[model samples]
Every structure is written in C-alpha cells, then in structure tokens.
Target chain A: MGISGAAFIAGAYEHPLRVIPDKSVAQVHAEVAAGALADAGLSFSDVDGYFCAGDAPGMGGIGMADYMGLKLKHTDSTETGGSSYLVHVGHAMEAIHAGKIKVALVTLAGLPRQASANLQMGVTDTPEGGFENVFGPTIHGMYALAAKRHMHEYGTTSEQLAWIRVAASTHAQYNPNAMFQNVVTVEDVINSPMVSDPLHRLDCCVISDGGGAVVIVSPDVAKGLERHSIKVLGHGEAPKHSDNGKIDLTYTGAAWSGPAAFDEAKLTPKDIQYASIYDSFTITVLEQIEDLGFCEKGKGGEFVADGGLISPTGRLPFNTDGGGLTNNHPVNRGGMTKILEAVRQLRGEAHPAVQVPNCELALAHGTGGSIGTRMGSATLVLGRD
Target chain B: MTEATAPVMPAPAPIVNPENKPFWDATVEGRLVLPKCQNCGSINWYPRVFCPECGKFGVDWIDAAGTGTIYTFAITRRGMGAYGKAGPYVLAYVELDEGPRIMTNIVDCDVDSINIGDKVRVVFHDTGSGSALPRFTPVS
Candidate 1:
C-alpha cells in the first residue's frame, strides 16, 4: 500500500490566532478532499474507502461521507484524539491488502478558532471529566505534570524543553503557512508566561482552523497513477490505560507502538532519515524520541539538547512542517499533518528550507489525549519507492 | 452609598452517577474510599464496575489511609472559565499508600515550593452542595 496524493487546506494567515468564519468544517474537508484527489489524478468515484475523526454533528465518518457524497464500501470513524489519522493509515493498509478497498481517503478538519462555530471535540461528558476535570487540570497542566515529573526523575531542565520549541520554530521559518515564523531562543521560551508549572505559554501548541487530506491506494492502483507514491512500509497502534486506570505517567503507548512499528518495518531507528513526531507539547516530542528507541530512557532531554539533532541538517530532522508548536494544530488532529509532511519529504517536494538532503525513509508518530492520565499512540514508517 | 461584594468562585462540580455515588457519599463524611478487587487484591481508581486487573465482579469499597506522596504536580498560572480567576494553584497526582495514584489539588502550601515525593494528607473542601471535595495539603 502507498499514499498517492496529500493535500493540506487552511486560511492564509501568519498570525498565531485567526478565525475563518466563512468556512465550515465540512467545507474545509471537501476542499482538501478534492485537492488530494486531484493531486493523485483521481476523481471522487475512484475512492472506495473513507476514514475521518473529530466530533462533528453526527457520526464522524458518515457525516463526512454524506457531505462529500462519497459512497464508500468501507468506512472508519476512529476517534482517539490527535493520533486518529495515523491509526487510520494502518487500518487502510490492512484493508487494502485484504482486498477490502482499493482506494482509501482519510480526511480531517476543524474550526477551533472560528467564532461562528466550535468544532473542538466535547470532553465534558467523558470519564476523564468525572475523574480528573474536577481538580481543574487544564490540558496544558496535564502535560506539565509529566514535564515536572520528568524533571524530577531524570534531572531534565526547562532549558532542554525550550530547545524542542526552538527546533520547531527554526523549521517554521521556512514554512510561510506556519502560525509563528519568528525564531525564538531557549531563553525566550523559558521566560514566556507560565501556563502551568514547568510549561510556558510558548510550550503549548497554537490553536488554528485548518484541515488536511491524504489519498491511499493499493500497489496496483498506485502503479496506474502518474503521480509519485510513498510506500507504507509498516505501522502500529496502541492504547494505554483507560481514563481512570493507573498509568505510569512517564511512559506512553508509544513505548509499545514504536517498537512494534520498527519490528514490522524491519528497520532500526538508525535508518530513519527524517521524523514527523507529534508536538502537542515539547515534552511529547521528547518522550516519543526516547520511547521510540531513538535514545535511552531518561536521556531524551540530553539527546534533544545536542546541537542540530532536530534541525534540518541535524542527525534526525523532525517536524519539518514546523509541527503543531508553530504550524497549525487544527483541533489537535496533527497526526494528519504529520503524515502529510512525511509524504512530502519522501516525494522530495518539501520546502527547501526544511528538506532533509537525500531523504529516503521517514517516520510519523502521534500521541493523543492527556499525558498524565490515559492516551493512545500511532507510529508509521514510510519510504520512497 | 453602596458597597461592592466579592464574586463567588466558579469551579467545576464533580459528576456523581450510579456507579460513583458511594464514592462521593463517602467523601462527604471525610473518608476516602476506593474499589478493591477481592479476587486479586488490586485497588482501582475512578470507580469501575469490575476489577480491571482480575476482570472479576467481586469489587468492594474499602477505606483508604488518606496519606500519600506527590508523584507529580503543576502550578497552573491560568485556568479555564472561573478557574482562571483562581490562578497559581497546584494540580497534582498523589500516590496513595494503598498503591494507586489519584488526581487532586494540593492546597495550603506555596505552589512554587512543592516538590515531587512531598508527603501529603487528604483534606475536604465543601462544594456547597452537601458534598465535600477531597483535596490534599502538604503534611508538615
């Protein structure tokens, strides 16, 4: 299985906060779907499978299929926060190999910044609300709890966390569509207003209104397409404890998913040329780097602090699209964007500023839900064919 | 001449349902209760219908010691909605002596001075709805 076309759609604004009042969530999804299909030189009729996430008015995937007029043979509406789309890629691959569907279109869109509507997923009625929300732990506070614990257990410094933001911002400088293009230093990130203990305001991902779509096809279908296709080498997904279940706050589902992905891909971390790990928070990237076997446990802070590890010319160029830290978050469905960037990198079409030279293999990883409580993770390995 | 009065603090109220009614009822009396699986001796948090460890329905409520250590914490300088007005508060997970980490708010201590592994004891704050919310304060 391979990805034939990838397209991202959002308002043209460089400011960190802007609302696209005119466009609804469905409108954005339709635009991105058309663009992606066109990129692959295919039409709507060519798509036989549909996958989507996020809370819309009705059933997630059914709503999108109705709005886009996509009559599909297979559908998946898996909702696991930001990592939903990455998991979709794995599901699509399995289904294609089994002859369940020939062409699958995975789409994601949200309007969090729009004043006219609220598209963020509702969490008040969830089990997390019953157990954790009573104490007033904001999403940032939850991730901050992990950061503080990491600092306490591993002697990680706030300076090292700031470096993660610095690396993402540096990559954002080349992405004209990124929310924040100004390069910031470690001091700037550390001195920014504290949203929660150990997490500065700059440590959080920017909220934005955007959407993205990707077209996946079986090898035979991909062979017929004129566009270049990126091979889906292997993938894995895992769910940690439930909302109220006991969890090791330092470890994430990535610990299981990452190794499973690498094993199936038959490749080690050393073979990866580029990475597009989720960046809902700086600690997220740091945790995934260590959990994905890029570094030893508790050595993530030191590994990331090393000069240019995440830079364009560094040992592992990651989040080349600026990531959620600076780029658009689009209702925290960043896994979709992560996949989009990995496809671009393998296609040799990434922006020259953040492109890794001679890039052959790339990894896309996503973490969803609160870090302190329960969450899910998905990892994918893609290669140029 | 008129005088202005202080506004009432706005905090989210805990949702009490059929599955968790007993847990909340016990808190009103200033006792912390958790579900314990008699089959496997595994303590469960968040109140589940069955034992997550043993997958048995022989779970029973047991009184906890109310003493624990801070596993992790965050000082929230900004909050959502009414919580925003109550800035610089400590939100933390306290690992109970019974072997379960529970989410709580740490009170009666400097938010900046709190550290992981700090000993804490449970304290109840009245929610004005006849139910007391369980919070933790450093055990000096």
Candidate 2:
C-alpha cells in the first residue's frame, strides 16, 4: 500500500557551474532537465509529470512545463523553500503509485548569488510580517537564534559545530565543481568572523547560481530504461512551527519526518549507509543528526567530532559530493542537491575517493524555510535494486 | 566597553493587516495587548483573530504584563537591507510573564551580558508613522 518500490529514480544531473552569470534561471532548468532525461535514456517528450518549486522561473510548475515543452499530465508546484525538491520527489512517487503518470521530471534552478541583494531585501506581506518584519531578522540572524539556544540547552560548543564544516571540506576536496575545495581545520572555522553570534562565516553555505534535475519513473517504465535505477523506499514530510510562544529550539521537524520515513521503509538509522543532510549552517547538521536518530538527542557534538562525518571511516559517510555546506546551494535551495547525491551513492556513481564501498541504502533529508522560524521538513529513503 | 548602544536600526514599517491591526494599534498608546480566546481562554502571540487552539472567533485583546525574561537571543554581527548599518544588535525572544513569548530586540544593555532567563520589560519605540514597535530592555 506504500510507495516502496512503486517508483524509481532513473537519472539525476547537477549543473556544474557554481555561478551562472550568463544564463537565465529557466535556461539552467531546461539544460539540467535535458541532461537528466538523456542520462535516463529517455526523451523530454517521455516526461508526463512535471515537479518544481519556487526556484523555477515564471509560474513554477505550469510555467516550466510550457518552457520545457513537456506534455505533462500531472504537475506539482509545492513551494517549501530549499526542501521543495525532496518533497516533490515524494509527491512524484505517490502520483506514480496511484497510476497518474509514468515518467516524472523534477527540476530546481536559481540565481541567488547574482540576485543576492534583491533576494535578501524581498519580504512578502504575510499575517505575521507585521510582528516579525519590524525586528529586522536576517537569514543568518534567524539561524543564529536557534544555534545559540541549542548551545545553551545542550552545551554544544562552537568547536563541535566547527567539525561539520570540517567534514564537508574534507569531502569537497575531491569535488571539482565545489565552491570550496580546500580542507579547513577546526581552528579555521572557530577563528572565522562571526556573522551572527556562535555561527561563523564558514558555518554558512555558499550561495550559487546553478540547478539540478531528477528523472523518476514508474516501476513499469523502468523496465524499458537502460540506466541503473534507485528505488523509492519511503518518504515523509512534516512542519514545525513556533507553538504560540512555546518554541523548542533543540529539535527539528526531522524528529517527526525521519521516523515516519524509517517506519514505512521498515528500517532503522543503523541500516542507512549514507545520508545527504541539509547543511545551510553547521547548527543545522548538528541538530538534524540528533533528530534523525543517528545519535542521542544531545550527543550530536560527540558523534560529529574526530572525523566522524568523513568518508570511508565514518559510521555514516554523508554528503560525499560535499553537500551544500562546501559545494553549491543553487539559488539557495538545497533539497535538489541532497537527492542528487543520494542517487549517486545508491547507483555507485559517486567519486571513488569518497563513495561508500557499497552504498545499499541512503537517506536524504531537507529543511525548508528558516530553522529559527516555521519550516517544512522532508525525508526520503532510497535503495538499490 | 560594550557597543550595545551602537546604532538602533529603524525597522521597516510593518504591513498592518486586519488580523493584527488592533495589536499594532494598542502599541501606539504604549500598551501591549494579546489575543485571548473567548472559548478556550488560551492566549496566543501575533494576535490572530481566531483562536488557534479552540478554533473560535470573538477573541478579546487583553492587556499583557509588559515584563518578561529572555528565552533566547543572538547578537547579529552582520545584517542586511535597512539593518546593514546597525551593528551588533541583540535579536531575541522574551517569554512574557503572561505566558506568550514574543520576538523583539533587547536594547539598553550590554550585548555580552544578555543571557537566557534574564528579566526584561517592554518599551515602545515610535516608528514616526502613527504606530509604535514594542522592544524590550533589561529589567535591571
């Protein structure tokens, strides 16, 4: 009755450019779409379902469907910030499970680095804008609030948080397209200038102008494909908001989403061979690791320390493609890259230096919106056939 | 030597809406009011018209105790847009005595001295455009 084995991710393509100054956002989206379709040994005309998020140019899914000339029978324009693509992947699986479409195409693209000023200044008028807008909470400021609260409540230190950036850098060394390639030490992270209290500049992800696309197909459609397909084992999504005034900064929506996903997959955290966690900030990785049941609630600091997240030797080798922390957070949306890496690992297509020996099961988790405020979280479990 | 008094960034005028108009209106008179559900009696922040708990209308704006304690805070060293020039400001949420926590800036104190559970009281800052924004200052 579940989506397990109902759909397969046939192809994934991450646009190589970290900064695309010459190309438009829609152009990047189209390029990645073509690349993924070609990799899957399918044509653009084969795609019957289109999935995108706020990053897509024009009117999201509908607009992109037209731009890509995709004759889609189904489309989803679910906007969940950076986690939109992960959520879209889950939604695509449900559609395939229900026999709505055969070949589903999911894409994300943005130029946040080029439009940094406008993106930061742009504020939508929501019901809560009146109360929050007047406080001038920047993106860094919002995440810093959560980081400070976690440190206060759990005794998480800046040195421990620095290790996340270190782990990411360690893997980024092998990624030719990574925005940061040099391995950084704990001292480098600790000594970096603080953008917000407790969160150093290195703790933040690089803003890039790139895009990625994934081709998901029904199990029936996969029989005709030549590329190795990764099975959709389980998916879960949830939201965590400030409960009136009672807000707990110690945990994330992953606490709910991760377990729901594992339950459906009939697996535990121990079974996950790889994880592609959203890394918008160091505190994000630390908190999600705890919430994902990788370790005890307050023991993420110890779990992530001493080269624990480094590839080959770590208990769970994560973000082998360097992840958003060191590679690219295209258009500031990281959900797309999370899935791309997990697919790479499951297909044994990752760089040999950082790839898990036999990555059987992988988990990719994404948190959309600000961690200090309300957010949509999505978790996906994928496996090799 | 704390530069906590560094420049107070004038907040961009809030987009006042019907759901939160009364809450902003009360701040002009230097009074803090919270929406209390007439059905469940549970209070909520952001002054919503309907009760988030009981799902009923006819909520009342009750006067709130202006005093609270710092639940959490971060000293933002860098800011964007209008806050770009305002250096080293303490952005925080204070758990009000009335039980609802509110997001506000903690002014008139050393940034390094502010900690979770520190007592604070609300102070109204006139926005020069008919409404006032409620900020907090250390109780001590």
Candidate 3:
C-alpha cells in the first residue's frame, strides 16, 4: 500500500543519434524519460530522483541524471546482472517510505552495438564486502542447471519444459515490439539446437539493445501529479548468498516470499488477474509459479502442457505482452514492461486483443543469478484502489 | 590522490575453513569421502560437523562408493577462464550410488556416449602435485 505515479516506454537503440555522441547515452535517456513523463502526464522537473541499471561507458545513475538536466535527490546504480530494475523498485519504495524524496525516473540501457571478438570489457569495482564471481558462472549455464534440477525433482519432462516457449511465442505473435514474434509450437522448441543441455536455444531469452523507463511518486506526491494512482500494495525480496560454502541448487525462496508478501499486501493469487513474471528462461517461470503457489510444485509441468496461457481466457493470463523470452529484453526494460502493462490494465489501455477483464491487481516477479544456487527474487503487487 | 578503479573480485583461491579440511584433504588423497552422521547415519558431501538431519555434531568422514549415475550433463561450448581453452568438455552432475550428488567432470568417453541416467564409474587423477580431482567415466 504505497507508490503512486508510474509509466514505461521502450525504443530500439542505435537510431538517430549517430555522429555527435558518446555512444548515444544521453539521447537515449531523454527519449525514455520523455515517454515516461508523457505516459504519466507530467514534465521533467517533477522528477527529483533517478534510478538506473546500466553502467555502460561513464554512465551511472547520477551521471545520467545530471545530463538529463535535473538534480537527483536519490539514486541507485544497483547492478546485479539482470534483476537490477525490479530490485531497484524495492529500494526506491523504501526511500519513498523514508519521506526523503518523491518521483523517481528509472531507466536501463544494455545494447550490443555490433559484436566484436574482444574478451576484456571494462573491469568492475567490487562492492562493500560483496561476494565475488569466482565460481565462473554464466547466466545461461545456471539456468540449464535449474531446468535439470526441476526435471530431476518434479518429473517435469523436457517436452513439458519446451511448452513455455510455445506459450510465449503465441502471445508475442500479436506484439510487434517483440523481437521474435514468429508463432511456433512445442515441436519447434524441442527440435531447436541445444544451447545448454536440457535447455534449447528457444529456452533462453534474446539479447537485444533497447531502453525503458518508469516514473513513480509517493501517494502524497501523486495526489497533485495525476488523476489516477495505481497504488503499490506490497513488495517483497529474498536473496541467496553466503561468503562461505556449498551452493544448494534447490528450493527457490520465492515460494516462501510470495506468500509472505501477499499476506502483507492483503492479496491472493486469485486476485491477481494478470501477471508478468521475468522469463529469462522458460523453465524459471514455471518454477516461480509453482513455488509462488499459483499451482502446486510438480503440477506446473502439467499446467504448461495443458495450454494454461495461450489466450486471455486461459487460466491465468501471463506475460500478456511477449515476455523477455520473445519480447525485447533490454535487461532492466523487462521490469518496465510489467510495470507499464499493469498500469495499462488499471487504466484500461492494454491493446484490446490481449486485455483482461477487470485486471485490478497485477503481479510482477523478478529473479537473477545464472546458476539457481544464488537466487534473488522481488515480487511487486499493485492494484487500482 | 585520485580514486582508483576497484577490482570486481578478490583473488580466486581454493577455499579452506575449519570444517571443510577433511573434504579438501580427501580430494588431494584421491579418495571421495563424505560426512555421515554417526548418530543418525545420514551421508552428505562438502563436509560439515553438524548433521543436517539429527542436529548432532557427531558426523564423521566415510569413504563413498565411487560409482554414480550421470543425472545430467552438458558438453560446455564456452569454456570459462583458464578452463575456457579446454572447450567442449562435459560437465556433469553424478548422483552417487550412495544417495548424494556431486558436480564433477565426466571424462574417458566421447560426447555422444554420455546420456542422462547412464552408469558412471569414478576414477581419480593426480595434478602432479599433492592434489587430485575426482572425475567419473561412463560404465561400459
């Protein structure tokens, strides 16, 4: 029961800003900021805080904020691989609670502009007593391990795992901004080249260059800012890490956190009419729903096989706009899509083809770390009061 | 003085703490041993003093049967760091005949020979130093 103002925008990078630039950072930030402000029906001055996920070149949160011609009251350049933006929202909400700031503009830009075969990118600074990446983990291989673990435990067959791709493509076919909108079936997912064992090429989300932003203000700030407020009903977070020892590759904390958060927000799975789960891999989403109590743990494999969500009328309309698996994965842009879709449903602005009836409350969940051994999850429950 | 760019990670070194010495020692000795709860008799790897099941610190090292099954594996295309040059090698999880899984390399066979649930017999290879790494091979 908290936040108020929120809007989102997405656009292809490497366009328009060619010659006079440092990798099109500023121009890209402005385009997204404008889109967000426009969606919320506000101007730039209303944004006093900034949160960003990308650290490409010399750009961080305040670095981009200053160039956007605004003095940021609060900022976070929090980067934890892919789940940064979703995690940032939890941080921003905490700041809002402190009453130190209002109105934050969050943005992300991870674009691969023409691939080169160079190994060394810029080195990263270790955070204060943060765990090191000594395990030599890749995001892809970790997801493969998770798929295998889920298969080992739940009797979740590889064929059932491929169904996630089928469901995602079916929805993305109606979404133009989606990178791979071609409609495909389960056979396509199975026949696809193996990227990691048990995880085929279609199992992984695409890597695309894009930017997205969302503007959120506190309830007090929202009264004067806009006519409608999609109140943040609840937020929850859980992390998997320890400076010492064995990585247990089972049991997602979200299974516990989802119920805990719903209890706090005074909501239930049934009340959530539409959901946008981070789909870095098809199997991850199935695990999240099972663990989050959308369905029983072993039952998820069957849920997907039964065509649980190919159309709006399906049991639970999930990732209504193509998810990261099919849609544009601007990294942080993935989180923005969910926040934007929730606001659209609350405002009844979702394209009629995939709109839900009375989608009052929405759920957006995000998790990161390639190997499921180290997992971080944040769930957002928002509603139209 | 200027603020210097910081290192993203600490130097990668083999980890050793008070509780893990036995497990590390066994790896160097070419013996696969896991701590079994002497009180409740539960077997587990990556050794610990306290038994997870019985909440007792009576667990002690026992030599495990080297035999296991290839629960799952991947012929890694992208090798990592020093290991990257050893590309297209199989990294597998072996579910031991004694009821525990350990992540180890699967060798002594071609890529086409490995499949899920295939029987594996363990062999230990020395690093020419005091240490050896336990790896498994597909059972004929």
Candidate 4:
C-alpha cells in the first residue's frame, strides 16, 4: 500500500479575527479531491474507494462519492474525532491489499469559523453531556487535567510544555500559510492568558478552515504510476474508554497503538528520521512522544525540553508544517494534515526551511477526543520507496 | 439599538436515560450509588446494564461512601460556550475510595489552592431543574 498523490488546500480566507465565510466544507473537499486526483495523474472516474471522517449530516464518504459523481466500490466513514483520517488510511490500506479497491481516496474538511451561520456540526445532547459537559469543562480544560496529572506524576514543568509551542511557532515561520508565524518565547507562552489550569492559550491549537486529500493505491498500481509514491509500511489504531469514570486520564490510547505500529513496521523509534505527531495541545505531543517509545515513560518532558530533538536541524524533526499549535487545526481534525506533512517530508517537498536533510522514513501520529477521558489514537509509518 | 446581553450560563443538568435513571434518582436524595455486580463484585460507574468485569447482567445499585481523593484537576480560567459566563471553576477527576475515578467539579473553595491527592467529599448542588448534580469539595 502506498500513497500516490496528496493535496492540501485552505479556504481563500485568512483573517486573524474573522473567517473567510466563503467555502462550505463540501466545496473544500471537492476542490482538494480534484487537486489530489490531478496530482496523482488520475481522475474521479478512476477512483474505486472513498473514505472520510463522517462530520456532516450524511456519511462523509457517501456524500463525497455522490458529489464527485464517482461510482465507488468501497466506502469507509470512520468517526474517531481528529484521528479519523489516519484510521481511514489503515482501513484503506487493508482493503487495497485484499484487492477490494485499486485507488482509495481519503479526505477531510471543516469550517469551524463559519459553523455559526452554516450547517454546523453542533454537539448533540448525548448521555455524556449530563456527566461531563454539565460542569463546563472546555476541551482544553479536559486536556489540562492530563497535563496537571503528568506534571504531578512525572515532575513535568510548564516551561517544558511551553517549549513545544515555541518550537511549533519556529517552524511556522517557514510556513506562509500557517495561522501564526510570530516566534514565541517560553516567558511569552507562560504569560499568555490561561485558558485552563496548567495550559496557557498558546499551549492549545488554533481553529481554522482547511481540507486535505490523499490518494492511496496498491503497490502494483503505484508502480504503474508516473508520480513518486510513499509506501505505507505499517499502521495501528486503538480506542480508549470514553467514560471518565473508567479511564485513567494520565495515559492515552497511544500507549497501545504506538507499540502495535512499531512492531508491524519492524522499526524502533530510532529508525524514524522525521516525525509528525499531532499537536492539538503541547501535552499531547509530550504524551505521544513517550507512548510511541521515543523516550522512557515520564521522561518526555526532559526529551522535549531541549530544542534540538524537534528543531528542523535536530536529530528528529517533528511537525515541520508548524503543526496544529501554530499551523492550523482544521476544526480539531489534525490527522489529514499530519499525513499530508509526512508525505511532503518523504517527497522532499516540505517547506525548505523545515525540511529534514536526507529524510527517508517519517512517522505521523494522531490523537482525537479528550486525553483526560475517552481518546482515540492512530500511528502510521511511511517510507520513501 | 441597545447593547447585546451576555449569554446565559448553562444549568448543570444530567440527561437521565433509561439505563442511568437510578443513579440520577439517587442523586436527588443526596446519595451516591454505583452499579455493583453480583457475579463478580465489580463496581461500575456511569451506569451499565451488565458488569464490565464479569460480563453478567446481575448488577445491582449499591450506596457509595462519598469520600475520595483528587486524582487530578484543572482550574478553568476561561470557559467555553455557556460555561464562558460561569467564571473560573475547578474541573477534576476524583478517585473514589470504592475504586472508580469520576469526573466532577470541585466547589466551595479557592480553585487555585486544590492539589492532587487531597481528600474530598461529595456535595450535591441543585440544577434548578428539580434535579441535583454531585460535586466535590476538599475535606479538612
């Protein structure tokens, strides 16, 4: 299984205070789909499989298939919050390996800014609303709980967490489309308004309107194609119990998914040349770095405190596109962007400033939902062939 | 025209579905109850029909000792949506003496003074909807 083509597109609106308010999620998806197909030198007529996170009224894949006039042979609409697309990539790879589909397309798009006026994906009044939502804990607040616990249990400091934001903004300086490019210091991140305890405003990701698409094909189909392809060496996914009563807030599903992915890829954390771990929050990157076996458990703070590990010129470059913290969150769905950056890094087409020299293997990981409660994790190992 | 009014804070109300009705009902009487399994003695929170550990439906509601310790907590300086108007509050996970950790808000004290592993006891607050929601406050 290999990704033959990929495309990332943002709505033509870039105002710091206001949204573009022009394109719908479907419109963004359609454009990204067409662009990705064109990049693959293929057309909608050639797509046999469709996959997407079901964030819209109807299932996203079915709606996309109808909108693009593609008669798909397979469709996957997995909803695992931000990590849904990475999980989709794993599913698409399995289906393609089984000869179920020749060319599979996975797409994601969201318009969080226009959600108020447009068809918003409003939170439904579910059962958990009574238990969890009643207390008014913002999404950041939930993750803050994890950060507090991690600090309490492992002696992690706010300064260490602030460094992740600083690193992200540093990378964003090279990205023209990033939401925030201004370099920030640890003191600046600490001085920022507190959204929740243990997390400053800069510690969280920004909301943006964007979409991305990736075209996956069987190895044979990729071999026949003219464009360069990146092999999907391995992938794994895991779901955590959503009920806060049962979940251990300090740990996440990545503890399971990361090991599974590494085993399947037959590679250790040392083999990775580039990394694209999700950055919905600074603590998220810390947790994943530890759970992915890059460092010892509870040692992520020390591992990331120094700028060299994740800096572009360092041993392991991560989130080269600035990540969600400084780049874009796309309605809190970061898996697509994570995959897009990994592909770009492998193709040697990443932003010149953040490009890892002689990069060959890249790892992209994603986390969805609240880390303090129920969360989903997905890991993918991609390699240049 | 006139200035826009601030949004109303959302009331703390629990959605009492059929599976979790008994738990909410007990909350109204200032009692905390959990589903205890007859087959394996495993206690379940958030209401489940079958025991998670034993996979049996022989689960019964049992009273809980309202004492626990703060497993972790966050002081929300700025809330979101309706909660935005609610002001700073403490959101935390309290690990009950009986074994399950529950999501709750710590109340009746300064939010910044709370610490992990502090002993806490449950206190019921009226939702103004005839139902009460359980919160925790530090115990001396």
Instruction: Indicate which candidate wins on DockQ.
Output: 2
RMSD of each: 4.6, 1.2, 8.2, 4.8
Q: Record all residue pairs in model 4 with backbone atoms less than 3 Å apart, i.e. clashing.
A: none
Error of 1 at A140 (Å): 0.3
The residue-by-residue lDDT of candidate 3 on A227-250, one tens digit each, is 466767777777764212334454
lDDT, residue A263, model 4: 75
Which residue pairs does candidate 2 place in steric collision?
Answer: none
Q: Can you write out model 4's per-residue Cα lDDT over A152-231, one digit (the tens) per residue?
A: 99999999999888888889898888889998998999999888879999999988877778888877777777877788
lDDT of 1 at A86: 86
In angstroms, the error of model 1 at A64 is 1.5
Which model, 3 or 4, shows the larger DockQ? 4
Instruction: Tell me the lDDT of model 4 at A61.
Output: 73
Per-prediction DockQ: 0.53, 0.73, 0.12, 0.51
lDDT of 2 by residue, A128-247 (tens): 767776787888888888999888888999999998899999999999999999999999999999888878999999888888999999998898888999998999899998877787
- List runs of model 3 lying over 4 Å from the truth: A1-22, A25-27, A54-60, A116-137, A241-250, B1-72, B75-88, B94-102, B110-134, B138-140
lDDT of 2 at B12: 68
The superposed Cα distance between candidate 3 and the true structure at residue A39, in angstroms, equals: 2.2
lDDT of 1 at A141: 86
Candidate 2 lDDT over residue span B1-140, tens digit each: 55664556575677777778888889899999999998999988767987778778878999998999998898888767777788888888888999987788998888888889999999998887767989999987
Model 1, A1-385: lDDT tens digits are: 2332221111111222334678777877777788788888788888899888764435868888888888899998888889998898888887887788888888877777765332222337565466677677788888998998989888989999898888989888888888898889999999999888789988889888877788888888888878887888878899887434455777788999998888777888989999998999999888989999888899988888854555566757898888899988876667888888888888887888878887888899998887777788999988887
lDDT of 2 at B1: 54
Relative to the real complex, the DockQ score for model 4 comes to 0.51
